[model samples]
Target: METTPAPSNVDPNRTLLLVDDDDILRERLARALAKRGYAVTTAPSVAAGITAARSNPPRYAVCDLRLADGNGLDVIAAIRDINPDARVVMLTGYGNIATAVAAVKAGAVDYMAKPADADDIDAALQASGDTKPEPPDRPMSADRVRWEHINRIYELCERNVSETARRLNMHRRTLQRILAKHSPR
Candidate 1:
């Protein structure tokens, strides 16, 4: 607990601390969570997250595994120190079962890929115990992994569908068609 105060609009009881390095994504996520009526305090680096969490503890946290300054696992560690009861969801752009397992072992209640939505994160935070989802322990084929990453990133970008489409260098329709094929029946 440091001296930094919670945002004026935040109710100390139900606030959520969000730690991510990606500025645009972090801000967008904060907005989305705020729309859901949860107070949000954002930190763009590990040190900042730790300081912010210690200063104004929140009921729950969503942290990116990688950050511009350092690893977000450090943020999780600090959160646990400040409030052991705090729920945490670990997020990463490079999704892997090992990282998920490690995050849980290191204090995260759950782990997920970066493109996760605010709702998914909210669900993780709401869990009362270990919330990690153990994806099958097997190496995915390169193509399969790429496809999964693409879809995840697309979902994360939300309105930036065109950016994702451009990155893939295919027309928006092509990307849309591919996503449609993969959608569950």
Candidate 2:
């Protein structure tokens, strides 16, 4: 029987490590990436991710910026230590310029906000050196930006609702309501 070759864009070493605390997101992304031809391994925290990387380094990684146990930047550092050429992408619910810069400095090739679909991630993973990926067709709306900013401040305040509210100059009850709701698209 004759067989067709894999696409040139697909890496020969298709090993990928995905580290995210969100169980549903992790599984869904893993399945989608697998369909795209990656051999995926997943972890739920910084420690697990580091252990996995040390045991069997991956050629690509998608790590959450805020893990249950610790920051995902630590995982990126570990992966880079194991294989400097590894392509790591940072995913965060609280997306901001500072965190994105930090992710890049920590060895992540790209930074994506939460709710990133599998297709967008796949494209990012396939991006070659120095080549910028296409911008999102629908950027986050103003409401979404406000939501992200509020969430970022909340995190910075160590998740203290009152402190976040004070910093954002929003009423505590109002901030609480916002926090209770899902992020705006």
Candidate 3:
């Protein structure tokens, strides 16, 4: 879908909220974002982040999908309530396409893995897409989530079916069954 550009010049009125469970990373990101000319508020958990967003909605938000109290979606929802126009981004270390798709479905302008730089955050805020795509083309679905999870586990296990199955809380036979059902001959 087509997108518009947010103002290139940083606006003082456009503040940012940085939400992550990692204290050190959150502090570092907060300082970095502040230096970039954004008035930033940092939160250590989903609940705290939601509280902060409710108090004063930010124009931009960078949130970790996994948080101590809950998922970042709750924080994103709070921000939406406070400021529907705010651009939200989900930053996660568990960089699975499934989660990224889910984040976008949950109202993120975009979703990116962690260890991202300021530029990534900037790009996400400038994206004009909504939580869901326009008609016809839809977001990822349950089958995608399951397949993604299975593939991720398999990758970690170096394609060892037993190991992947154990980690996924499924039997080896079950994993094999799914793989056999899904894999191309």
lDDT of 2 by residue, 1-185 (tens): 01123334555598889999988888888878877888788999999999989887899999999998999999999999999999988999877899999999999989998767787887788899968678877777889877877887897799999899888889999999999999887
| Candidate 2 stretches greater than 4 Å from native | 1-12, 145-169, 172-185
Q: Estimate each model's TM-score.
A: 0.67, 0.75, 0.63
159 in model 3: Cα distance from truth in Å?
24
Candidate 3 local lDDT, 28-84, one digit each (tens) = 777677766677888888878887887777889999998878899888888887888
For residues 72-151, what per-residue lDDT tens digits would candidate 1 score against the true structure? 88889889888998888899988688888889887888887756767777767776565444343443456565677778
Question: Least lDDT summed over 10 consecutive residues: which range in candidate 1?
Answer: 1-10
As for TM-score, the candidate ahead, 2 or 3, is: 2
Q: Whole-model lDDT, candidate 2?
A: 0.85
Off by over 4 Å in 3: 1-10, 128-185
Q: What is the lDDT for 43 in model 1?
A: 87
Q: Sort all candidates by TM-score, best to worst.
A: 2, 1, 3
